[model samples]
Target chain A: MREVILNSYREAIRDRVLLVVLAFGVAMIFSSLIIGPLTLGEEIRLAKDIGLGSILFFGLLIILFIGNRVLYRELNEKTCYLILTRPITRFQFIAGKAIGLFLTILVTSLILGIIFISYISLLTGSLQITAFLAVIGVIFQLTMLVGIVILAATFLNPFLGSLFTIFVYIFGQMIPRAILLAKFYKHLAIARILSIFHYIFPDLTYLDFRELLIYNNPIPLERILFGFSYAICYSLVMVLVAGLIFERKDL
Target chain B: MLATFLFQRSIPPIYHHSEPLAFLPSGPMVEVTTAPLGPISPEIIWLAAIQYYGEEKISGGKFEFLTQVFDVLTRIDPLFDHAYQFGSIVIADEGRSPEQAIRILKRGLVKNPSSWIPPFYIGFVFYIHLRDFAKAGKYFELATRRSGAPEYVYRLAAFAYKKVRLRKGSILIWSKIYQNTDNQTLKEAALRNIRCLILEEYLEYLNKGLQRFEREKGRKPEHISELIPEYIDSIPTEPFGGAFKYDSSRDSFISTTYLQIEKIIAYLNNKLHVFKQKFGYYPERLDELVAKGVIDFIPPHPLGRIYNYRFGRVIR
Candidate 1:
């Protein structure tokens, strides 16, 4: 399991897609400084806005595109067959791949987040503490997304799995509103469907610290702890489901 | 074989299906809200600008387009505070109609009462643009009362009251700041400045009325009351409840008792102007004017109570 995890981490680091995603995130943050003058109020606001937005957008893109393709690539290359021929169980293989992808996402997000914060601070002359925490929230959301993508890739082709994961990410952010709309509809079918989605998808809205950043409000420590716990539980559920599916698949 | 088939059937449907789950519902269901409308297009924003400005080129079609744009933006994201901020400022300042801006801001505040930006703009329009200090003060007061209003709101409200000569109102507002703020130096400085300013304005009006009387009559009045019929609508009362003093020997009015440093400054400025006009140059010292019986005594600075009457050459 340890060897598989190490190999997967090395393979993800060498992936061209990960490098492109990281570069795109850095470029977007740089572009924010150019756009800063056009916005009203202080220049710091526009820079912080772009920096926080870029981190979330690029992190999700990496999780969706690269994460969805990672497991499928191993299967298509018959690497999974070679690995399963070894003494390792399929469950261990799936866990190692998921852990490796999660670690890649974690490191990539942290590097981009630090660059974004430093650049914004340089431009604005004040560090946005809320923006720093918001980037962490985005990273947590992306980690949960990685789990969902791994689960989807276990049964679906890479393209379909990626599309579905993207759909889940968008809808996950709108879950509270969706639930409210469902209540207004007074239809059990719609409510049940929305409820199932609420349970299955990570509540990405919980990770939204954009208001705190914009208003310069301090995020409560308790709320951060709750959000961290939710991400862990949600990611564990997704990985467990993915492991069960991979365990039954024929090599 | 039968047992294997049964076990496979009992397994979750996810394990049985090699294909990806296609759970997306089919058909164009009737959406109650519709796709949160699109962003207000740039053309619509241009049209709105034109319509609001009453440009000759903007037709009825363009006016309708602008309304649609505002409607779409508000509907799609009501919490977009910039739309309210920029939109209301354009309406009030450019459109020259505070009523229109108030309507737009009221709608926005109904949706988001907790937002401070809209109220700030509203108060700014009333105070700065319209010169409606009372209404401006009310809006600013309301803004400061809100949960998330900035510290600047309180400061601005105090300023707006001062603009319209509402000294008591301004003092009341600043007193709130003095009570609430932790900065002892700032609070003390602000209180002192407010007291000085209120007294200064009062003395200024009296001095101007007195000067106007002297200009029109070609001689100084026997009493300040004699000028009230022609030069002033009413006598200017001192801010801190003291009568302005007049000295017959020096032929000058003084406000030293009430600690009106600003009044004394204005008196010196007027004396300097009169001296330059008479002698074709300013006095070498304020005492030269005292010898000429133009002033009874030079008033001291209110803050430091220091005499400051040395006349310097006018730079201009």
Candidate 2:
């Protein structure tokens, strides 16, 4: 498991595509400073929102386009055939990929978050602690996203897997809001089906602290802890489900 | 290059008082476009709205794309409190649509039940611009109970009640403002309000006494002092130490003024505004006040003449 993790990290870190993603991500985050001047008095807010939004966007791009292909590349190159014959299990391979992708996302988010915070503090003469919390929140959300990507890749091609993960994210964020809409349904059967769908869906918005940063709204200490625990717990469950499904694959 | 691209797009086609057509396909349209990106869609829209706001101001007091962009932003993230604040100002102050601004703020208040700033701003639009003190008081009272609100929100609430002539609802808040503030200008402002409300209170007593005297005598009193002792106590002194009078011919209660001529004109102008709001235009003349039974005769000016009504203003 440890060797699988180290190998995955080394492989991703050496990829030229990862470097390209990181470059664009970092540049996009810094571009907020240029865009800040266009707003009336919401300069800090507008810039920080764009910066944080860029980090989230580029991070997802890496996971969907690059991260989802990690497994396919291994299989196509017969690296999985070579590695699977060793002591490592298929679950360990998928888990390693999830963690490695999460590490890459964290590194990219940190670089972007730091650039954003520095630019904002330079502009405003004050550093907002909420900005970092927002970054931390993006990292947690990306963790779950990485899980969804890796789990879906086990069952489908890289393109289909990325497409499926997109639905997963959209559905994940919309479930809480959709549940509120369920009451408007007149039929009990329809409401009951929607309730079942709502219960089974993952909610990604709890990890969305970006708005909290924009508004300077404080998230209580306990809720922050709950968010961390929720992300970790949710991601572990996804990994567990992936392992159970991938362990018996004929590959 | 980016600016040119947006201008070429010319935003999207929109209909007046219709479902908003966002230049960028806002709210649900934006949500669908950025769905795969997660909740960051609204933040992206917020940034775009900022850019749009910066660019569209070249037009003279007209924001063709203003409501479309802001409406979509608010709809995308109803929790976006600052958008509500800035949206209302842009609509009210710049777009010349105070009613539209109030509508936006009211929806924001409903969406953000715990927020005080929305109600505070709503109160201000009614009080300062619309001069609908009752409407202002309703929203300001809502703001008073919201957490994280400033002390001034409460003061405005109190001031609104008093401004609408509900003098009893205003006393406690005015007293609080008078006692708590150390800023001389604010203290003086609050003190003046308190004195005005106090005079209204005293006037309430005098009015009841006059009614009693009229009922007993079957005619108006001959002298100002006739209502005193039997119908009331000593005459309540004017808050600014002026005298009171009774006019038998006009059947009017008159209060003498030591107020500046400008203030007197301002006071009469405010009454005229109220009259216009009621009758849909300025009264044909000050004597119309007697015909409408609003007052028995014209209020006296400090210059020993009637207020010079010119072009809808009572000038010196």
Candidate 3:
């Protein structure tokens, strides 16, 4: 599993898309710095807001573009057979790949985050712990995203897998709201169906601490603990499900 | 290259003859749809709102959808303080909807109870635009209670109370500032305003008592304390430590503190005369001094009395 994870990481890092995404993300941060002064008096705020946004967006690009294709390409190219003949189980392979993808996202977000935080510090003449924590929040969100994409890639073609991943990502964020809406309009059947999805889907809003950054308020310890616990468990469940599907495939 | 340029030039520009923010979804829908983007979504929408406001200003059109655009933005990012702050101002001053401005600022207050800015802006709209000084004083007082509120908000709160002739409320806020501030200058300023407010309170109390006594007895009271048990509960202590006197010629109470009130009355009457000279008629309202740029704000009468505009003169 260690070897597979390292191999997956190396393969993902070598992809040109990673460089393009990182470049775009950095460019976005710079653009934010340029536009920051134009947002009236909210210079630091706009810079930090746009910087965190750029990290999340480019990170999502990497996930949807690379993550949904990596496992599917490996199976189609018979690379899994080469790995499966060794000591690695299908579960270990899928889990390793998901972990590697998460690491890629984590590193990518950190690189963007450092530039963001450094720029914000330069502008404000102080270190921004809120910006740093917001980056951590983005990393947690991407962790769940990586797992969902890996699970989708196991069952669907790459194109459909990416689409399915995006759908789940969007719907996952709206899970609480979907349930509320269903109940609001008095649709009992729809409410029941959405309630099932509520448990099945990870509520991504749990990982969003950016709004709390505005007040410079410290995010409570319980909330951070819950976000970490939920992200890891949800990703583990996704990898476990993908492993089940991948283990039964004839390929 | 010339053919391509010509083709581009010949292409008809897509003119938007539609209203701004017309296609914006409801706040709840925008909230759910933009939920995935987190705070980024509001920033984008806020940029769009700024552009829309600029275009509306340039085109001289009513900002028909200003409220809805900001509503969606704030709903998506409730902590988006700039959207609430800037948006409410544009909605009130340019969009001409002080009520909508208050609603948006109030929404911001719900999300950010610790922030003084939203309440301060709400107070400004009430005081400057709607001229509802009581509500203005209420919100300004709320703002002064918040953490990190500036000393100016205390002054604004006191000033707003005085605008509505609520001298007691004005005195309380000024007294609070006088007690809390470490700045010697501000302390002195607050102390001065408090004394003025207190003197105004006492004069009004005595005058109202004199009126009630005259109304019942059908004759003027010879002494200032004659109506104590019936008209006033007690003769309040004079603010200047001087005794009140009954002036039979004018049929009103008098004191050394009346000197300050007399000066203010003379100044306002002179402004009224100037307005009459310039415009050939007295302003129907005293705030016309502010509207005509002769004064930044209507000066509060020292006796907590509303100035009545009559026949080219201001009488308190």
Please name the candidate that would achieve the greatest TM-score relative to the true structure: 3
Q: How well does each candidate superpose onto the true structure, as a TM-score? A: 0.58, 0.64, 0.70
Instruction: In angstroms, give how far residue A120 of model 2 lies from its true place.
Output: 3.1
Model 1: residue B194 alpha-carbon error in angstroms = 24
- Which ten residues in a row are the worst by lDDT in model 2 chain A? A178-187
Write one digit per residue (lDDT tens) for candidate 1, span A1-251: 88888888888888898899889889977875665444333345556666776777777788777787788989999888888889998888988998988888888989988898788677668876766788888888888988899899999998899888977776776555667667766766878888887887678767767667665656788888999889988998898999999999875
Error of 1 at B31 (Å): 15
Per-residue CA lDDT of candidate 3, range B189-226, in tens? 45666666676677778889888787889988767668
Docking class of 2: incorrect
lDDT tens readout by residue for model 1, B1-316? 9999999999873311111112212112212232211111222232343334232111101121233334434443456565666556444433345676676666666766777766766776676456688788788988887787877688778778777455554455456545644334335534664665666666676678877877887887788788666776776665445667655665556666553545666677787787778778877555445555667665544452223333342211
TM-score ranking of the models: 3, 2, 1
How do these models rank on lDDT, best leading?
3, 2, 1
* Whole-model alpha-carbon lDDT for candidate 3: 0.78
Among the numbered candidates, top lDDT falls to 3
Task: Give candidate 3's error at residue A67 in angstroms.
Answer: 1.0
